[model samples]
Target: MAANKAKRPLPSAQPMRHNPNPQQILRPQYGLRISPAGSQPQRSRLHARETAQLMPVKAHVYRTIAELNGGFEKVIQDLQTLRQISFFRNDRVTAMHDLICRVRAQANRDFTMTLHGRELANAGHFDGLCIEWEKQIEDRSDT
Candidate 1:
Protein backbone atom coordinates (compact mmCIF):
# COMPACT_ATOMS: atom_id res chain seq x y z
CA MET A 1 0.00 0.00 0.00
CA ALA A 2 1.24 3.52 -0.83
CA ALA A 3 1.22 6.17 1.87
CA ASN A 4 1.57 9.92 1.69
CA LYS A 5 1.86 12.65 4.37
CA ALA A 6 1.97 16.43 4.50
CA LYS A 7 5.63 17.38 4.03
CA ARG A 8 5.84 20.32 6.48
CA PRO A 9 2.45 21.11 7.94
CA LEU A 10 1.74 22.99 4.68
CA PRO A 11 2.92 26.23 6.36
CA SER A 12 0.83 28.21 8.84
CA ALA A 13 -2.23 29.58 7.09
CA GLN A 14 -2.30 33.35 6.88
CA PRO A 15 -5.46 35.27 6.12
CA MET A 16 -5.07 36.76 2.63
CA ARG A 17 -5.55 40.51 2.59
CA HIS A 18 -7.04 42.25 -0.42
CA ASN A 19 -3.82 43.15 -2.15
CA PRO A 20 -4.60 46.75 -3.22
CA ASN A 21 -1.81 46.94 -5.71
CA PRO A 22 -1.38 43.37 -6.91
CA GLN A 23 1.68 44.58 -8.79
CA GLN A 24 3.49 45.01 -5.44
CA ILE A 25 3.32 41.30 -4.70
CA LEU A 26 6.73 39.64 -5.07
CA ARG A 27 5.20 36.69 -6.94
CA PRO A 28 2.01 37.79 -8.62
CA GLN A 29 -0.71 35.21 -8.35
CA TYR A 30 -2.72 34.64 -11.48
CA GLY A 31 -6.14 33.12 -12.17
CA LEU A 32 -4.15 30.22 -13.62
CA ARG A 33 -0.69 28.99 -12.64
CA ILE A 34 1.81 27.88 -15.28
CA SER A 35 3.08 24.60 -13.86
CA PRO A 36 3.80 21.06 -15.07
CA ALA A 37 0.04 20.72 -15.55
CA GLY A 38 0.92 22.57 -18.78
CA SER A 39 0.57 26.34 -19.37
CA GLN A 40 -3.10 26.07 -20.24
CA PRO A 41 -6.22 25.70 -18.13
CA GLN A 42 -7.16 22.10 -17.38
CA ARG A 43 -9.91 21.28 -19.82
CA SER A 44 -11.88 18.09 -20.24
CA ARG A 45 -9.37 15.34 -19.47
CA LEU A 46 -6.99 14.79 -22.37
CA HIS A 47 -7.90 11.63 -24.21
CA ALA A 48 -5.41 10.06 -26.65
CA ARG A 49 -7.10 12.07 -29.40
CA GLU A 50 -6.54 15.47 -27.75
CA THR A 51 -2.93 16.66 -27.88
CA ALA A 52 -1.48 19.78 -26.32
CA GLN A 53 -0.44 22.36 -28.88
CA LEU A 54 0.94 25.36 -26.99
CA MET A 55 2.13 28.07 -29.35
CA PRO A 56 3.12 31.26 -27.64
CA VAL A 57 4.12 34.22 -29.77
CA LYS A 58 7.17 35.93 -28.32
CA ALA A 59 7.46 39.62 -27.28
CA HIS A 60 10.54 40.42 -29.36
CA VAL A 61 8.79 39.13 -32.46
CA TYR A 62 5.82 41.35 -31.66
CA ARG A 63 8.11 44.33 -31.19
CA THR A 64 9.86 43.63 -34.48
CA ILE A 65 6.61 43.52 -36.41
CA ALA A 66 5.31 46.66 -34.70
CA GLU A 67 8.48 48.42 -35.73
CA LEU A 68 8.04 47.22 -39.29
CA ASN A 69 4.42 48.31 -39.70
CA GLY A 70 4.02 50.91 -36.92
CA GLY A 71 1.79 48.35 -35.08
CA PHE A 72 -1.07 48.66 -37.58
CA GLU A 73 -0.59 45.19 -39.09
CA LYS A 74 0.55 42.93 -36.26
CA VAL A 75 -2.73 41.60 -34.83
CA ILE A 76 -4.32 40.59 -38.14
CA GLN A 77 -1.02 39.11 -39.33
CA ASP A 78 -0.76 36.96 -36.21
CA LEU A 79 -4.40 35.89 -36.46
CA GLN A 80 -3.94 34.89 -40.08
CA THR A 81 -0.93 32.80 -39.06
CA LEU A 82 -3.01 31.17 -36.34
CA ARG A 83 -5.74 30.24 -38.80
CA GLN A 84 -3.22 28.74 -41.20
CA ILE A 85 -1.64 26.60 -38.47
CA SER A 86 -5.09 25.45 -37.35
CA PHE A 87 -5.54 23.66 -40.71
CA PHE A 88 -2.80 21.14 -39.97
CA ARG A 89 -4.45 19.98 -36.77
CA ASN A 90 -2.12 17.07 -35.98
CA ASP A 91 1.11 18.01 -37.79
CA ARG A 92 3.27 20.75 -36.26
CA VAL A 93 5.84 21.24 -39.04
CA THR A 94 3.12 21.43 -41.63
CA ALA A 95 1.35 23.91 -39.42
CA MET A 96 4.48 26.05 -39.36
CA HIS A 97 4.50 25.93 -43.15
CA ASP A 98 0.94 27.04 -43.02
CA LEU A 99 2.02 29.96 -40.84
CA ILE A 100 4.48 31.06 -43.52
CA CYS A 101 1.78 30.74 -46.14
CA ARG A 102 -0.53 32.91 -44.04
CA VAL A 103 2.09 35.63 -43.78
CA ARG A 104 2.81 35.42 -47.48
CA ALA A 105 -0.90 35.52 -48.14
CA GLN A 106 -1.20 38.63 -46.00
CA ALA A 107 1.58 40.35 -47.91
CA ASN A 108 0.09 39.32 -51.23
CA ARG A 109 -3.34 40.51 -50.20
CA ASP A 110 -2.00 43.84 -49.02
CA PHE A 111 -0.24 44.52 -52.32
CA THR A 112 -3.20 43.31 -54.33
CA MET A 113 -5.55 45.66 -52.46
CA THR A 114 -3.24 48.61 -53.03
CA LEU A 115 -3.04 47.85 -56.76
CA HIS A 116 -6.74 47.29 -57.03
CA GLY A 117 -7.52 50.57 -55.30
CA ARG A 118 -5.09 52.56 -57.46
CA GLU A 119 -6.52 50.96 -60.56
CA LEU A 120 -10.06 51.84 -59.48
CA ALA A 121 -9.14 55.48 -58.87
CA ASN A 122 -7.42 55.67 -62.27
CA ALA A 123 -10.41 54.00 -63.92
CA GLY A 124 -12.75 56.55 -62.34
CA HIS A 125 -10.68 59.45 -63.67
CA PHE A 126 -10.49 57.92 -67.15
CA ASP A 127 -14.24 57.27 -67.15
CA GLY A 128 -14.98 60.87 -66.18
CA LEU A 129 -12.66 62.20 -68.86
CA CYS A 130 -14.37 60.03 -71.46
CA ILE A 131 -17.74 61.53 -70.51
CA GLU A 132 -16.29 65.05 -70.60
CA TRP A 133 -14.81 64.42 -74.05
CA GLU A 134 -18.16 63.18 -75.38
CA LYS A 135 -19.91 66.35 -74.08
CA GLN A 136 -17.20 68.52 -75.66
CA ILE A 137 -17.71 66.77 -79.03
CA GLU A 138 -21.51 67.40 -78.86
CA ASP A 139 -20.92 71.08 -78.07
CA ARG A 140 -18.42 71.42 -80.95
CA SER A 141 -20.85 69.78 -83.44
CA ASP A 142 -23.59 72.21 -82.36
CA THR A 143 -21.18 75.15 -82.86
Candidate 2:
Protein backbone atom coordinates (compact mmCIF):
# COMPACT_ATOMS: atom_id res chain seq x y z
CA MET A 1 0.00 0.00 0.00
CA ALA A 2 2.86 2.49 0.67
CA ALA A 3 4.47 1.71 -2.65
CA ASN A 4 1.16 2.24 -4.45
CA LYS A 5 0.50 5.76 -2.91
CA ALA A 6 0.60 8.64 -5.55
CA LYS A 7 3.11 11.58 -5.13
CA ARG A 8 1.62 15.08 -5.18
CA PRO A 9 3.32 18.16 -6.65
CA LEU A 10 3.95 21.17 -4.32
CA PRO A 11 2.39 24.59 -5.28
CA SER A 12 4.54 26.69 -7.61
CA ALA A 13 5.79 30.08 -6.33
CA GLN A 14 5.22 33.11 -8.55
CA PRO A 15 7.65 36.13 -8.80
CA MET A 16 6.33 39.59 -7.75
CA ARG A 17 5.88 42.11 -10.61
CA HIS A 18 7.61 45.49 -10.34
CA ASN A 19 8.27 48.45 -12.66
CA PRO A 20 11.71 48.36 -14.28
CA ASN A 21 11.87 52.13 -14.97
CA PRO A 22 13.23 54.12 -11.99
CA GLN A 23 11.09 57.12 -13.01
CA GLN A 24 7.96 55.03 -12.49
CA ILE A 25 8.70 54.85 -8.78
CA LEU A 26 6.53 57.24 -6.80
CA ARG A 27 8.77 59.83 -5.03
CA PRO A 28 8.68 63.50 -4.17
CA GLN A 29 10.13 65.64 -6.96
CA TYR A 30 11.42 69.21 -6.78
CA GLY A 31 8.60 71.83 -6.47
CA LEU A 32 6.14 69.05 -5.67
CA ARG A 33 4.65 68.26 -2.28
CA ILE A 34 2.10 65.96 -0.71
CA SER A 35 -0.41 67.40 1.70
CA PRO A 36 -2.15 65.48 4.43
CA ALA A 37 -5.84 64.98 4.12
CA GLY A 38 -7.82 67.95 5.56
CA SER A 39 -4.79 70.21 5.39
CA GLN A 40 -4.79 73.44 3.36
CA PRO A 41 -3.75 73.14 -0.25
CA GLN A 42 -0.58 74.84 -1.41
CA ARG A 43 -1.22 78.27 -2.97
CA SER A 44 0.46 81.64 -3.54
CA ARG A 45 -0.88 84.04 -0.95
CA LEU A 46 0.63 87.02 -2.77
CA HIS A 47 -1.12 86.07 -5.97
CA ALA A 48 -4.37 85.70 -4.12
CA ARG A 49 -3.93 89.07 -2.45
CA GLU A 50 -3.16 90.68 -5.80
CA THR A 51 -6.23 89.10 -7.38
CA ALA A 52 -8.36 90.26 -4.46
CA GLN A 53 -6.97 93.75 -4.82
CA LEU A 54 -7.58 93.79 -8.56
CA MET A 55 -11.12 92.39 -8.44
CA PRO A 56 -12.56 95.51 -6.83
CA VAL A 57 -10.90 97.78 -9.37
CA LYS A 58 -11.78 95.48 -12.23
CA ALA A 59 -15.32 95.48 -10.90
CA HIS A 60 -15.69 99.21 -10.14
CA VAL A 61 -12.93 101.25 -11.78
CA TYR A 62 -14.90 102.36 -14.81
CA ARG A 63 -17.59 103.89 -12.65
CA THR A 64 -14.98 105.79 -10.71
CA ILE A 65 -13.47 107.09 -13.92
CA ALA A 66 -16.86 108.17 -15.13
CA GLU A 67 -17.49 110.06 -11.90
CA LEU A 68 -14.23 111.93 -12.11
CA ASN A 69 -14.43 112.64 -15.84
CA GLY A 70 -18.15 113.49 -15.83
CA GLY A 71 -19.61 111.08 -18.39
CA PHE A 72 -22.17 108.25 -18.56
CA GLU A 73 -20.43 106.84 -21.59
CA LYS A 74 -17.78 105.36 -19.36
CA VAL A 75 -20.45 103.95 -17.05
CA ILE A 76 -22.17 102.32 -19.98
CA GLN A 77 -18.91 100.82 -21.12
CA ASP A 78 -18.35 99.61 -17.58
CA LEU A 79 -21.72 97.88 -17.60
CA GLN A 80 -20.81 96.11 -20.79
CA THR A 81 -17.64 94.78 -19.22
CA LEU A 82 -19.36 94.01 -15.93
CA ARG A 83 -21.94 91.92 -17.76
CA GLN A 84 -19.21 89.65 -19.03
CA ILE A 85 -18.04 88.76 -15.50
CA SER A 86 -20.08 86.01 -13.82
CA PHE A 87 -19.41 87.23 -10.27
CA PHE A 88 -20.55 90.84 -10.64
CA ARG A 89 -24.21 91.18 -9.70
CA ASN A 90 -26.95 93.66 -8.85
CA ASP A 91 -24.93 95.35 -6.15
CA ARG A 92 -22.27 96.36 -8.62
CA VAL A 93 -24.90 97.56 -11.06
CA THR A 94 -26.47 99.67 -8.32
CA ALA A 95 -23.11 101.11 -7.46
CA MET A 96 -22.59 102.00 -11.08
CA HIS A 97 -25.86 103.89 -11.05
CA ASP A 98 -24.78 105.78 -7.96
CA LEU A 99 -21.57 106.67 -9.72
CA ILE A 100 -23.52 107.94 -12.69
CA CYS A 101 -25.42 110.25 -10.38
CA ARG A 102 -22.18 111.53 -8.97
CA VAL A 103 -20.88 112.14 -12.47
CA ARG A 104 -23.97 114.16 -13.25
CA ALA A 105 -23.43 116.20 -10.11
CA GLN A 106 -19.84 116.86 -11.07
CA ALA A 107 -20.88 117.95 -14.55
CA ASN A 108 -23.45 120.31 -13.08
CA ARG A 109 -20.82 121.88 -10.86
CA ASP A 110 -18.49 122.36 -13.84
CA PHE A 111 -21.25 124.00 -15.88
CA THR A 112 -22.15 126.30 -13.01
CA MET A 113 -18.54 127.36 -12.61
CA THR A 114 -18.19 128.10 -16.32
CA LEU A 115 -21.40 130.14 -16.31
CA HIS A 116 -20.31 132.13 -13.24
CA GLY A 117 -16.94 132.84 -14.78
CA ARG A 118 -18.49 134.14 -17.99
CA GLU A 119 -20.97 136.29 -16.05
CA LEU A 120 -18.19 137.79 -13.96
CA ALA A 121 -16.20 138.59 -17.07
CA ASN A 122 -19.22 140.32 -18.64
CA ALA A 123 -19.83 142.34 -15.46
CA GLY A 124 -16.22 143.45 -15.39
CA HIS A 125 -16.30 144.50 -19.03
CA PHE A 126 -19.49 146.49 -18.41
CA ASP A 127 -17.86 148.25 -15.43
CA GLY A 128 -14.84 149.17 -17.57
CA LEU A 129 -17.06 150.60 -20.29
CA CYS A 130 -18.97 152.72 -17.73
CA ILE A 131 -15.73 154.07 -16.31
CA GLU A 132 -14.52 155.04 -19.81
CA TRP A 133 -17.85 156.80 -20.62
CA GLU A 134 -17.67 158.78 -17.36
CA LYS A 135 -14.13 159.87 -18.13
CA GLN A 136 -15.13 161.05 -21.66
CA ILE A 137 -18.15 162.97 -20.24
CA GLU A 138 -16.00 164.68 -17.58
CA ASP A 139 -13.48 165.73 -20.24
CA ARG A 140 -16.28 167.08 -22.51
CA SER A 141 -17.85 169.04 -19.61
CA ASP A 142 -14.47 170.49 -18.66
CA THR A 143 -13.86 171.62 -22.27
Best by TM-score: 1
User: Which window of ten consecutive residues has the lowest lDDT sum in model 1?
Assistant: 47-56
List, in order, the clash count of every candidate structure.
0, 0
Tens digit of per-residue lDDT, candidate 2, span 1-143: 13423333223223346656665344333333457878754535644443333312132333443344544555666676676678878677768877777777787688557656665665665666689799999999999
Model 2: pairs clashing at backbone N, Cα or C within 3 Å: none
In candidate 1, stretches whose alpha carbon ends up further than 4 angstroms from where it belongs are 1-90
Best by lDDT: 2
* TM-score per model over all chains: 0.35, 0.33
**Which runs of model 2 end up more than 4 angstroms from their true locations?**
1-90
For model 2 the TM-score comes to 0.33
Q: Would you give me the overall lDDT of model 1? A: 0.51
Residue 100 local lDDT, model 2: 76
lDDT of 1 by residue, 1-143 (tens): 24433233222233356757756343334333334643544334432112222222334543443344433344445544565665645465556556666776786677557656665665665666688789999999999
The C-alpha lDDT values of all candidates are 0.51, 0.56
